[model samples]
Target: MRLFGRKNGEDDSAERIAEFWRWWEGARPGLDAKVAAGGRDSLASLAETLAPAVSALHSGLVCEVAPGRNAAHALVVTAAGDAELRSLAHRWALAAPPADLVWEFHPSRQANPQAADLTLRAGDYEFGVGKLVLGLRVPRGAPRVDVSAYHPIFSELDDDTRLDAALLALDSVLGEDDVARWVGEITAVTFQPIDAVPAVHLPAVVADLASEFDGEQWVALEGKTARGRPLIAAARFPLRPVDHPLYDQHLAVTLPYAGRDGDKLPTGASVEALRDFEERLTRVAGDWVLAAHLSAEGHRIFHLYADPAGEVRRQVEELAATWGEGKARVDVAGDPAWSAVAAFIS
Candidate 1:
């Protein structure tokens, strides 16, 4: 029940990250000894050192030690279902010390096969994973899956506590990262429904649904600006914010091209320059992170999402400055909900 990390703004730099690893290298032996001796509060007791060090990287990030997949333990840095901080947890895990026999690193809570037989206690309620039942809902024509969880203990707990346990059970089976990406709204019910499947089947059910979203799909959206001016956009389908939890930060680039046939889409030599801009921007992105490419009124707007820790803003701004057609404007904002592109996404 003790959450680790500070309640202060994060310091995103190499210094804090390096400092944690340096401390980790020295503390490993002690930690291993404590765990090996079966200390009841082994990892939890390290809040003084381990907690502050990690909180320095990002206040929202918290760590816990769990039964490992292969190693003796897994040092998991989890975002606790906060999509905005998911990327930061991943970044922190990426900077971990190389793998060793004692510990493995995880960016998010992972599926634990052992959890199936585990009994979890919260307040006066005690329950095991086996007591849980799951119901899945796949919305028609949507790219995601919705899940409902049922447990007798839920009937005794408050709404918030019940949901916390339900999510915990799901994360234990489906893994945090995947659940964040592929799963949508979660509902908690005290009684098992006829359609409810056993908790153990959640992984397979979610896997089958996730596989459907494996390939890329896009849709064209035709709309008009506030002034009633016509605009068109090509955007990815199944545009769920959960799909790209890490892409919380948003970037919008306004590229003005002289050549266009009133649709505002790029044309002539301007088309080549816009493509070059896209290529350069993607290199900065290192992937096709474009949320949408829209032609609005007289200018072309590119909607993009990225990790705030990355130099996306600076890099994209630099590219805009070198725009050939005319002066380009780059705007960036933290948009973890991805609401900026709502108009474009179908």
Candidate 2:
């Protein structure tokens, strides 16, 4: 189910990246002249040529030309908001020519909230970004925002086209990376929901909310497992998986307790012991996040995320080996999306 173009768990080829950069440097000059002169034929040729060069890096990657912040035109090679492909776009950007009077490079679409007249077309419908309104809902105890959008023109298109248009407009304003990182679920609404706000104001709203998620706050929940067993779970209240993208490894430390009470929950003494172990483990597991934990079935599981480069997994393994509280089973794997413990927050 992986949607990104890089080979699963494999590094993208360096020589391939060099080849594309080599091609771009040679082709950029002529393309720049014709593009600046507004030559339609040259624009067509540039698009066709650029597609393969970018695809050579990753099939899922996309590129385009736009007015630039650093120069007259920007070559924006982007991940189109797919978080997994961001690194590919970044690698391409790193190899790009220096920004000059006519050229610049962008790894992702930069936000342009002041494009007051920004308009987009999809299917058979066209709408102004300013005319769009958004319905935002942050689940009472959850970490993300779910958005519903409305535009007068949505009435003219089918559901699929309507959603696509809404997304494209949002992506243009917020930039693809932020949209992918911060936004959860987005759908098109037929009518403005209860407290819809103007799309132009969305940038500020998202910024304010993002700042809150960046804070330190944690919450715990008690429930029953699907098998009707008692369970206790805890995690950072506003758990943002993309907050630290480099921490792509998932580590699960399972400690079976002989101290479970009648209800299959931890006894008082076991709870204190588990907490101390977590504090010590966390201190040594540099750049690690205890994403979530589950206490059920006579065992307490500590779900974690960490940067492999920090030797976090090795450090944690060392701690687990010397533990006196039953044999600790530590499992580690690649999960950049942090899907393993998402249920605790969701």
Candidate 3:
């Protein structure tokens, strides 16, 4: 039944689940508050009864949530010790495979045919898995699963199992075309697939590919396999020229921009700005290097490839702050060995 951490006379699993509910209900205010505060003891008490059911699911359970829904911070931990115990609400649903599972996202006090129609809020967004409604109040025209970076805990099954978890996760936000486009972009079936290679040999493949496609255009679109099995990236960059020496040349020289007091941001920007920011960066720094593209999900990413100099680091940091808080990161590399840093925007 439940995996008990220690030999406690009382049901530890139940206690943990109850603790989870308390945290979940408190996560978003409004009606959730009533459920979280009013049913604290009872929820914990019910956890004792549900412990056996909850433990039947997956092993090494972990739940990752954006701290304060900050989007920039992704906090991850095991189910038992997570900061957002509220995520336990989906334990029952996540344990089952995609086919056997049924869920919904509804917050109103009404009966539905859905199995786990539950609701929970993360940041200002509402997440509904199955029949569950995560957020009590939905923002004006906010698409479901608006915030990126979430993984559904699926049971390990046969390789033939083509469960599109990414598509389903944000079905509320994405249309069929959108989902298809994303899947197509990330899991391009046109690429060749090899046999089940050794796990230890992945680094070698990456290294070889990096060397072969050094001057070529490429992006690790999705760090996942085509058949939902583990996969690596081999897609070549299609937008830019291969011999672009901008990124590489910049890696040779130390940065020149540093030491800013107030926000040293570039002026004149709007949502409809026709100029591509990535292209702008390339053009601005064009004097020393060739052009390059930023990652696909470039919303909150920080892309800076500077030389291996201490002063470069400081300048890059200042640039990131000035350019508005994005997914801040810095990359520095010598001829072969490349160094990198990356941060996620919440």
Candidate 4:
């Protein structure tokens, strides 16, 4: 009796599947062409048939079906009545020619406008046919889901009950052939786990210094001293001199500091002091000093990219007299190595 019932159930499933295919084939031409032509009426018609199925999967669901590449179909599912429809329009795309599908879900859609939390992908792996940008978010107090079955989709399933129901539905609806096809497509795509890449480790002192100078104008490099103390170096390109014609013949002047009153550097003193000193230097040197660098040894190196007026040395001397307090020794060089250093530091 059990065997007979199983045979009957299989026959019924096959008949239903055949019916679905027939309906799809009849609707394909009109739906595909109209959607490809960007017809709203056709989309609404297609949505009438598809929306219920998607809504059953998720409450308050909005479903959109449109033409995809080569007479294929694309489906976008989102929260109902979302005013920002354009943002979710590309969430799920399906192509039938080579049997491809792509799905992206943004858990923090409002907080992060450009974030894609989880991505489900299948089909041709190369030429970007099945590519996904993965960085999923798990709700703070939600239960975790098993990831072995479908890693990307699993990352999205924070509600355990919903996940179980969805899994059951998927298993019931998908046949052996369907599962095989999906598995094949999924296996074909390549993916890298987010945890695979090692995190950058910075010493505490370097991190603190970097935080202080973090801005659009400066880039900081972290190194280590002889005794393993964190050494921080920074570079900045002055906007004023960058647009000048004499930008290429710059000389870099290095001035060492020991934190004494006469050898104090403005950057080491305070952020405001650094800004004030930079402004004064720019005013005095004009277009000659195009950039600047603060070395790990606390040396302020000025990039005088042009010395057309032969005033590079004079400018360095003036800077030392005004800000260096008579203890700073200015070494000005116009060598090719200095230019290379300036290029690198800037």
Candidate 5:
């Protein structure tokens, strides 16, 4: 049997395919007349013969295949004779199959005007393809034709496969020269990880706190500032002598202060006070404060992994005296041992 308009004994060469497209391009205006004169059998014959090739090309274009249908359908969006083509397609669809093959010839002007006069651009073709969309744009001048392939049978395939299929489809429709140009104009897509807050370490204070607690553990804390910058710190807590080293420590602190409106710490004097506080704690307590934050509530919270109980009390007293009383609070895990251990360590 003949396939894709090829005669049983006809030459099946790439050159022949090119010739067919060229002929179709030139003779497209008269196709409706030809079909009308050819009658139902001729249309069915055309559909049957073109089905495989059209389906293949569509698969390549969309990187997908329609499910449950033996025939392939295409939607050609163009700036040429769109209304006439749509009417012709509608008239054709009214007939019963095997002549009832589905195809659409649309004018981009009536649909997406942006795509109507689109030049050769490189980006993802979000439309046209049903699911396995290509990430390349075919170069076409104004008053040009753009093809879209659709299939209902869905399977999730990788990007590379879909792209390859798209290129192959382009090769069939626009031929190798056009496909090569498209490939040259193609752009790549990339992904990035979300930004993270920087981490802080305070070994000396951690060691001092470890000495007071039966056992001690440390953790990293992360949050965001009002302006969306990262806020990170380290935390320490007490563990019982019999507790496993890996056991979770409940004692911790969350730092910095923000305004009620989710604003960062005041830019001037408040900033100075915060820096001075960090420096003082480092000097007196051996850098136990991993990090600090100014909360939206106008409170400066300090995150500490280790605090000798007595030293923490003394630091709090001194900080209140300097920065104003009740302006800050130290958060620790609520355990009697955590409080008791702090008492003895300081």
Candidate 6:
């Protein structure tokens, strides 16, 4: 389908009206004089057939066609998912009869015309449309047409019933300049809370955690040995790599912080630097994207995990090196005792 600019470009409304008139006048050529005199039916068999074909394709697309919009020479379909739609388009192209044609697909969102031309330039045809778009190609004499389509997220359906329903809803779009299809899946919410005990080693619970939280690893927030003081150990796990619904809940309720009310202790520059570095690390790591909570009961310590990406790591390391190697313990984990613990660590 080719859509002409009705507003930004030339006078498209006038162009459309002219094209329609030209097509109407040329409906029949060299008609029998006697039949013409008898006033033959205006509708022709070829026109009727072509109309159905056009309608079939148009019924599946997802774009809106205005009165002066460009004419549709092909079909456009909109599907529930971005990726799924692209995949289907590819399959259809592979099964189509060969012809001299150009086909392609883009895996990106729609672009504004001010930034780049949304026109698809392939061989002799130039299609200028907008939105997340894809195209297909069929070489002359090839048995199958080539397909190109865009990929989107959260629209995949492996089940036949769901797929069928989604296709039915999007059956109107034969082709579009802007089309967004399914891309990926949304992972289920999961949480793993590690148990910490003072002066004792906790049992490993990897298997249990895996079953409960879809293969998540659970580390005991405990010390290396039973004889050693049960210090707060770090429990690291991979987040779901996307926005979490419970993020605000986790932040407002979980961050262990109690600013000085009246009993204020002068914090040295070292402490200030550590907090600043921690905040930076949190921002880079996307630590705030997921919901996590620290319970009031566990032997807990709050520290920022350094971002392994830049000078932050080097700065943190250099700061640590300022003290002797063995003397860095008090700073790294803080004193493994109650008095040195932050008030929020309660």
Better of 5 and 6 by lDDT: 5
Tens-digit lDDT track for model 4 on 1-346?
1111124433242233234335555665765565566565765676776654444333344554433333245454543222222212222222112334321222111111111221212221111211222222223322111111223333334455323432222222232112211211121112444532111111122234335434547556666657654455555522222123234354555555544333233344544544455677667644454455554445555555554445656775676665542245555433322334433432
RMSD of 2: 4.1
Task: Tell me the spans in candidate 1 whose CA falls farther than 4 Å from its real position.
Answer: 1-11, 39-49, 224-229, 238-250, 257-288, 306-325, 332-346
Cα error of candidate 6 at position 69, Å? 19
Kindly provide the TM-score of model 2 when superposed on the true structure, using C-alpha atoms: 0.80
Please give, for residues 172-201, the per-residue lDDT of candidate 1 as tens digits. 888886677677789888778778888888
Q: Assess candidate 5 and give its TM-score to the true structure.
A: 0.23
lDDT of each: 0.76, 0.77, 0.30, 0.38, 0.34, 0.27
Report the C-alpha lDDT of model 6 over 209-286, residue by residue, as the tens digit.
223434444343433334443333333343221112112111121122233222221134433543553454354333
**Candidate 4 least-lDDT 10 residues:** 106-115
Q: Give the deviation of candidate 3 from the true structure as CA RMSD.
A: 21.3
Error of 2 at 105 (Å): 4.7
Residue 206 local lDDT, model 3: 32
**Per-residue lDDT of candidate 5, residues 1-346 (tens digit):** 2223444854343334444355445544454443555665655554544444433322222111111122333333221212212222222223212312433332111212122122221233322322222222223321112223221211233455444444433433333322222223332122211221110111222233334444444544566756675544334432121121111123232233332233443455656656676677666553243422223345555534333323554555455456542344444442312332332111
Question: Candidate 5, residue 226: CA error in Å?
Answer: 12
Instruction: Specify the highest-lDDT model's number.
Output: 2
- Pairwise lDDT winner, candidates 1 and 5: 1
Off by over 4 Å in 4: 1-216, 225-229, 237-250, 256-275, 310-312, 324-326, 336-346
Clashing pairs in 1: none
TM-score of 6: 0.19
C-alpha-based local distance difference test score of model 3: 0.30
Worst 10 residues of 1 by lDDT: 1-10
Question: Where does model 2 exceed 4 Å of error?
Answer: 1-44, 71-77, 81-107, 124-126, 137-145, 181-184, 190-196, 211-214
